[model samples]
Target: MTNVLLDAHLNAKLADFAGSSLDGSPLLVVVTKSHRRPGDTCCVEADISAFASTLYTIVTGQSPYHDLSDYKIDERFVHGSFPQTDSLGPLGKLISRCWRDEYPDSKSVCKEIQGMC
Candidate 1:
């Protein structure tokens, strides 16, 4: 499971590094809620959010908002309606913080994760 999580994390990071096209065609499955808004650009917070979402996917064996259509997913994220993380324990709390933009940057998220170890 740890290996799966690490692989997913690396893949998500690679996709992010590849950069989004003008049409925003990249990693929409793990995009931050703020980035779903019009004219919003990627930021450190976005990276944290994406990483959190990726972790959620790996841990749960499913994508966040998996039941929703792309349009509906965008609408839900724009409205701050993320899937529940209550059952996920500590990791869920971390994911919640990232989705809520509570962390200032990825380093902060990394520190928190390191502490979890």
Candidate 2:
């Protein structure tokens, strides 16, 4: 398992690294990025970047980028550093990015919700 660094509010902790566990567990997917790297070698970020970004947004119905001033969400590609499946930072922010991108405006959001409903 690879151990990547996580920037916590207080301090970063060392945790085990897993991959694509999202397909099985929503809880694990939500917390995948926050997970600390147990060692200092492996990096699931590279391995699951493409899929992780997309999966995260689709599952949470949120964005995937941290700073999305001029961004848009698309299940096809949310490339960049992330927590789960990636090693960005807070999975929440990233998921939000995906949502914003997926739904560029209020109209889109309603449409998305309607589709889900």
Candidate 3:
């Protein structure tokens, strides 16, 4: 029982994010201009999804890091932002498509995403 908690907005975001990332992909990409990208890290969608989902769980009191999908997965192997050249394979692309499809309109995207994440 991981006592996770999350703000109202984040919860919604997580849901949108999860829904976006639910497709069958080995990895998903995330690029945050605010954050520093590690030289030996890649931002795959699944990693982003897993990170957000687990973090959301941690915040909302649903699950724990230990209980989420494989936590050992890391981006350091690819050393990039899951670029097309990054070689994430078809699964990654599939996840990317799902994610894009899930992208809500700006008017509702934020609020919807916040509700899940």
Cα lDDT of all candidates, in order? Answer: 0.68, 0.38, 0.34
Number of colliding residue pairs in each model:
0, 20, 28
Q: Output the better candidate (1/2) by TM-score.
A: 1
Per-residue C-alpha lDDT of model 2 across residues 7-41, encoded as one tens digit per residue:
65744454554433534342233232322211221
- In terms of TM-score, the best-performing candidate is 1
Question: What is the per-residue lDDT of model 1 for residues 23-102, given as tens digits with 9 covering 90 to 100?
Answer: 64544444343234323445566556667777888788877887777788778767778889999999999998888889
Error in Å for residue 114 of model 2: 31
Q: How many residue-pair clashes does candidate 2 contain?
A: 20
lDDT, candidate 3, 18-109, per-residue tens: 22334554325543321212332233433443343343333444432233233222342223322231143443343333233343333343
What TM-scores do the predictions have?
A: 0.70, 0.21, 0.21
Q: What is the Cα-based TM-score of model 3? A: 0.21
Better of 1 and 3 by TM-score: 1
Rank order (by lDDT, best first): 1, 2, 3
